[model samples]
Target: MASIRRLVLDVLKPVEVATVSFARELSDLDGVDATAVRLVETDREVQNVTLVVEGEAVDFERVEACIESLGGTLHSVDEVVCGEFVPEEHVAHADATWLR
Candidate 1:
């Protein structure tokens, strides 16, 4: 069975620099290592931006809380994606790593 991890991504208020930093930080997460978490479109009219996050389910809630703490509104959270590693694929390299 897969050890499913959860994740949630939050978009901090965007200034180019802040968005860049957020993207970098998110890339270092456990399951989803996203190189980009960008504001695609915005309601600059009201300051609402459509932010996209590429990450995993295991770390979802914590990530959501983080965004809220950072002054970003979490508009929605859906199970957008999932991932799993097959142990059988590692059989050939069983002695090569510790995760198995």
Candidate 2:
């Protein structure tokens, strides 16, 4: 079986609920599922919201569009760092230094 990696999307919007609704619509996509949905809170007004989605990368673009169509605009996408999907490997040392 093939394993899909996490796709991280950064979106900017006017309201928090708007972003949540966009994420909700993503769950209903043909091959998209939400492993996790996180909203980072800050005192500063939210100009950017990050959504981390776990699934096949093949469907990433379509899902991205769905998010945009739902009135949320995607600002950037970062491929999750994991062996199965992204080629890079992240390593932690005993001293807490990280290597990728």
Compose the digit string of candidate 1's lDDT tens values, residues 1-100: 3333433333436343365555555555566545445455555332333444454433665555556655566765533444553123225555577775
Ten residues in a row with the worst lDDT in model 2? 35-44
lDDT of 2: 0.62
Runs in model 1 deviating more than 4 A are: 1-17, 42-52, 55-58, 83-100
- What are the runs in model 2 whose C-alpha is more than 4 Å off? 1-4, 41-47, 56-58, 80-89, 92-100
How many clashes would you count in candidate 2?
0
Worst 10 residues of 1 by lDDT: 1-10
Model 2 error, position 25 (Å): 0.4
How high is the CA lDDT of each candidate model? 0.49, 0.62
**Candidate 2's residue-wise lDDT over 42-82, tens digit each?**
33545566777765543667776877676666777765433
